[model samples]
Target: MIKKALAWLECGEIKRLDWYGHEGNPSQLLGDKQWPQRLLPLLITGKLQMRVPSIHTLGSYQNWLGYSGSNLAVQNPKLNISSIIKTKEPDFNELKFHLTGMAGDGNKGHIWLLRLMQELLNRENQTNKEITSNLRKVKLHFIGLEIDKSASLARELRYWGRAIMGENFDWTAHGNHQDTIRSMAKANIAVSCSKAETFSMASLEAMHLGNLLLRNRTGGWEEQLLDGINGFDLGETEQKPGKKEIELVHRLRNTLITPSKKLTAMSIAANKHSQIFQNIKYANWLLN
Candidate 1:
């Protein structure tokens, strides 16, 4: 719809109100591809522009620059969404599955994680608690949906419950499901042990829900998580030489065994961080 709408509109001097400045992969939230290189010239000539929080500096450019020249930067770390109305928590009567991408894609291994989650469930008549103890209180339900169904990532997630978990895992491949966002926000904890994420909407949503985040230390998760506070970020041997991934995973797993005593404080921090991109405040900077 947006592509069609943009195609119909005349580009000459018309007011441009867009979230992304140029075409982005959509899989990642890093701003548009052309914006940085394109904007450099415009910025020089005084036609191109952007806004920033007083606290940010040009040095922050290192965060989002991919392995390319004229790389894009993500200065605006926080998102600005519309006001979030109070929502009642839905009864998690079943296991909730959020497979993010296609099975074969190297970058989209979160789909495989979802499959692993389902396989963990299907083993020999295990009760919900036996399969996933943390989620024992809630029923097990699986969901497969994304912004684009035709996307390879979306397709891999579609087959999650069918092939892996069998009939026990409920599958909803393509549909406009509004409940997903709200539910994600209400989850007890946001598990984003993904292989890669420059900036994760998943982690932010979990933060909004007052849920502890468990993620690796690469990418945006490292920037977001304040260790032993709201969440945990794992480390690599190179950074902390001779360390192991299993060790990091084990440490995080052990931490989750005990419910957080500082849950309230962490929740407050998460909520506060979420507000940075909640209102139109973020838009004004980019437009102005």
Candidate 2:
């Protein structure tokens, strides 16, 4: 099927091929073969145009072609931030944390989440006597909705999460985009644990909805997040427990200790920063 499609693409009078690489993509498959030799000529001669979502993707193509083309760069449609409204400030008693994506083994970082939740639970138990009443009762509720057909993985992860987090974790394997957005509005924090991404619309939507974002400092997120300001830079801590993971857990714990006013202010700042990716600005960029 991929060979036939590639043959057609090579022979067809197609002017442009806007490629978005994903798992099981034909371009990736063909690129591993000899598609670059066939496509590079067309690309260099301005007969074909290629656009990807991020510099990381562009770099991949450049490496495949053994040269960079003028047409290849990071470009993606702007997010519709119009539907996103500022959520009400969360109280200290219960704080909702959200993660939305495929529950696949490679995509979502479920293990990291389980570890973080365990750390939070341990912190609460250890500091129960020393903390204030509000802090003592504070609970971090994790709401995860799998957007792909990874039901079994989601179920398995949920079992582990429950073991680690007790009553604080919830997982849904079948969820639509609307359901995810609705849940995001109620969340105090939105986490993105993907090892790599082109452009994370979920993280952007979370920011637009005034949810504090904690995302890995890689891919398009590097362009979007302002470390320690709009969001925290989550480094590689998923494989093994490290300082970054500990710092993230500490920051979440500090949220319970911080005043509501300060947290609200931070949320507002995050929302404002996210406006750069709104539809209006995106449309203008397209026109220009």
Candidate 3:
């Protein structure tokens, strides 16, 4: 697929390429190690005009490729009909989390489920004790009906159910985009554990619908998601080498410690930030 796309960049007729970057790290995230080497020829020849979604990705590319060129730019991320999702009143009693994405995407593996499972197992096998009791208030909703159909995900979910067998937390999968939107509207937080992304549409849409996001600091996550104001950025803490899942789970528990009032304020800020995407479509912002 990449070969086919790159072929178009130098297919005799095209003068220059405006390559939009959507992946966080091609080497690690998308598992493509040779692309940077392949791109070097284009970069050196001044034929590749690289554009990325977030400021973070721009910086990352510069540092990774050591290319301090003038052909790169930060194109603002946008959403598609994001305002269709209606907002609802806050729910303080339970922490409802929504996670949505395509199931089979290589970088989009649902690794968070493993961290959650380890956390539950450490809490006395969901015995309704102090630790487990508090965690039971956490409900995770995996939106997009296709998630329920993924065989790979099914294996993780089976282990997930067994690990938290006696816990009261709700784990559900919804079928349609409307249902996904409704879930996001109702959720207190939205999560993404993708290894790499320029600026995830799920995170943007969730924020637009007034849901606090808990995601990594890849791409321009810092600019888009402000810690304690819009959402929590886990880039600094979650990416350590050989980090255990229990530690990740502990970080998740810490996120839940933020006061409900504070979270409400964060949600409001997220919604406000998302207004840019609602007003400006991606094509208009990128082209003209």
Candidate 4:
């Protein structure tokens, strides 16, 4: 818009306006060092009205408000843009887990998952007075591979899975990637134990497959997840939901114990509610 306007209007004219872009600043086209310093200054000074999607260039793009900000509505009032939109998870109904190997490794939330599992198991055991009630209810399947593909992280994840499962837990560990995907397909719910995420593909994929998502609160997860509606959002300390992590664990246990059929109903609601946002709509808005 700015370019055509500039060409049509008189040369050497400048105007004060806002500019936006995705991933990186458009002024960077001038040159690496000079993009921000030289060219963007000219455009901003020259009255260019630039707008970019906040999700694509969130922290990097300047002059534009964050995508989640209210300014986008001001600029384009008619556009119905949502932050994070997902599809409903499938109705597996039977509580099964196919934790991705990639998740339980790296400097990510692997340890957090272990700790959460332990806490949940302890709580479940206390409830039934058997100490193994929770462990017995949940069956984990490790689908992604490790060492044969030359990934040390994979090997570590496999070892950790085995260690966590132990002899008493009714769990199985597999290294076949295809079998893992199949297991994920058959599972009732998907659990994402990620520490940091800009957006969650695993969580989204689980939603797409009609499996209810049980995930942590961080990054773009908040934008995508609708607590108590589509799925459960855990460990949030805010007053809106008014529950801490410990409380969230209790709620989770309560939900699980109600019967798989009830959970399946929640999963259906989750999948139905996730269709509000589409990537193409976001893309078109950006291009517009």
Looking at candidate 4, what is the lDDT of residue 172? 33
Task: Give the TM-scores of the predictions, in the order they appear.
Answer: 0.52, 0.80, 0.71, 0.59
Consecutive 10-residue window with the lowest summed lDDT within model 2 = 279-288
Q: Lowest-scoring 10 consecutive residues by lDDT in candidate 1?
A: 50-59
lDDT of 3: 0.64
Judging by TM-score, tell me the better candidate of 2 and 4: 2
**Candidates in order: C-alpha RMSD to true structure:** 8.2, 3.8, 5.0, 8.1
Candidate-wise lDDT, in order: 0.44, 0.64, 0.64, 0.49
Runs in model 1 deviating more than 4 A are 1-40, 50-106, 111-143, 146-174, 193-198, 216-219, 234-257, 260-268
lDDT of 2 at 9: 61
Ranking the candidates on TM-score from highest down gives: 2, 3, 4, 1
For candidate 4, lDDT tens digit of each residue in 1-288?
A: 745544444354544334444324443543455334433444434444454432423443444322233322212112222322333344442346555545344534554554555565566656755423432255555445443566666566556656765542222344453444455666656666554443455565556556677666644455556776667766542322232554554554453455556666777765554444333353444443
lDDT of 1 by residue, 1-288 (tens): 544433333243533423332212332543677634543443443343333221122224423332222222244455534433354443223323343222334453454345444444443235344434443322223333453644666555546546665564443443433455555544544555455444666566656666555555434654567766775554421222123433333233222543334444665666666665454244445544
Which residues of candidate 2, in runs, are more than 4 Å off? 1-17, 20-28, 82-86, 89-94, 126-128, 131-150, 255-258, 280-288
Which residue pairs in model 3 clash with each other? none
Tens digits of per-residue lDDT for model 3, 138-241: 66665552444455664565456445633533444645677667667777787766666777777888888888877776655765787767876555424322
